[model samples]
Target: MRTFCVTGFGKKLKKHNDLLKIESKEDDNDEAKNLLVSPLDFDAVIVSGEHDITTGAIRLLLKNEIDLMILDHFGNPAGYILPCGKSKLIERHETQSRISSSKALCIAKAMCIASMINKISLLRSIQKNTGVDIETHIERIRKMTVQAESCLEINSLQGFECFSTNEYYSALMKIIPAEFNFTGRNRNPPMDPFNSLLGYGYGILYSKIRSAIVKAGLSPYYGVFHASYKNQEALVYDLIEEFRQPIVDRVVLTLIARKQVSSDDFNVTNEGCFFKNNFKKKYAGIILTRLEQEYTYENEKKTFSEIIEAQADILASAILETGKYSPFIYR
Candidate 1:
């Protein structure tokens, strides 16, 4: 299913016969600014910034079991409008709540290890492309993975994971073009263009994983790796580790390597680096396309979207004691 994103201010969505009609309130006479889409066109709608939707349109979406996601100014998910009868497995949530500490640690370690493995694989690809001798960094990350196998506490495992991530970023910085000014990973208000793209990409990834978790009948706030805090979807954070390197980082690095993006694509303000409207739209389209890209898994071709949904199911089965959980390791 596709995801329709609504951006900009003074926009309105309404039901027009069997189709959903979208138009700009600021210029109602402008046909070029209007769009008509079927409810079947997309399974989810992400509304960014200010917009208005008629009750009929909302009813149409709900009738089709479509999700409506609201994004804050930073492109982070503010909330969601799920259908009234969406699954809410109370038993599954109880099982999650009663998970033993040792099992939780096991899951956390597995996720971290899988994440490091994927990072190492990406680093190897980078090494091949840049011809940089980053064997030291690779070895260090490999060592961290080994240590993680025996890591006892969640905090300590995180420490090992963090160190490995630093080395991975360090290796990446060595090969990145000097013009990008990428030194390391930074977020919230990403200082550099690279980080600006990375942060936004992660935000989109978070939304995808969160949606997967919801569809899998799991609680996003209850997680194995990350502790729940106010308004935090800790499980989404946990699952995202295994994907950051393989999904978002790979795409961002390729964009840089091919010189497909430049400083003009971003807006550098005192607040931080942010994407220009044209580039943000294009980059988001690219990220969505990546989700749709297919790869071989279990001798069958599957999209990353399908794999993510499967991972969510795996997590649920683990919590329910029906099956084992293994994070997807990107090669």
Candidate 2:
């Protein structure tokens, strides 16, 4: 699926006949050029920064069944305009509520195992490339996987999951530069540059997964592993587990390794460490590019973005008892 991204400020989208007339300005004093695009050409349009969309253009997008994604200044999805009239909404919610405990446990275990496998894969890859030995952490996670498989309850499974996550971050700390001062995974105000980039990237991924869940007509508040709490998108949290190590972690590490980002690009405030405003746009671009990268999936190449949507649909089918659910494991 094609996704067109509109960035910068003072951008405008207007519907003209069978096309969308896009006007973009880099600065307020500059006269920008207008470009025409067909709504049929892309599956989604992402708007970042300050932009204007005419009512006619909104109608055109809606008529074409195109998703309209609005991104915040930091590139996290603020909101989305998805095609409406989803069928079986009541049935889907009812099925979700009635999912068997055994099935939920099974699904949750699969998700944790997938996450562990991805973590091991990443650690091994990093070790191989950087000549860093994290075999102890890797072995610990391998053992944790066996323990996780035997878990009879979600809480126990989560314990094993948490152990593996700590091991993964500890392994990363060994390889990440000392200047970054990464001391393991901490969030809700990440304390180090490494974690700052990680939190931001994960925020972007979270929004994408949440949008996929919404498009699949499943309630994000209901989940197999993550307990539903007030205002929590538990299912999104649950599903994001499988992709975190492979996507956001990989992206952040790659940026640091390649020197695409450095300590200077971030600032530590009383709130927490964070990327400077200038670096956020560049980091967001890299994350989006990674999402668009193609990888083998079920014998065919599919972008991570496509895979996310497919996984959401698969999960919905499983919850509705129309199909079986499988967690995504990155190679």
- The estimated TM-scores of all candidates read 0.93, 0.85
Can you list the residue pairs that collide in candidate 1? none
lDDT digits (tens) for residues 124-226 of candidate 1: 9998988999999999999999999998899998899789989999998888888778989887788889888888777777788888888888888888888
Q: lDDT, candidate 1, residue 309?
A: 86
Q: Global lDDT of each model?
A: 0.83, 0.82
In model 1, the number of clashes is: 0
lDDT at position 218, candidate 1: 86
Candidate 2 Cα misplacement greater than 4 A, ranges: 6-37, 47-57, 71-77, 86-90, 274-278
In the range 72-182, model 2's lDDT, one tens digit per residue, is 644455777776753224446877878898888988898999999999999999999999999999999999998888898999998898888888888888999988998
lDDT for residue 163 in candidate 1, whole number 0-100: 98
Deviation in Å, model 2, residue 163 alpha carbon: 1.6
Residue 315, candidate 2: Cα error in Å is 1.7
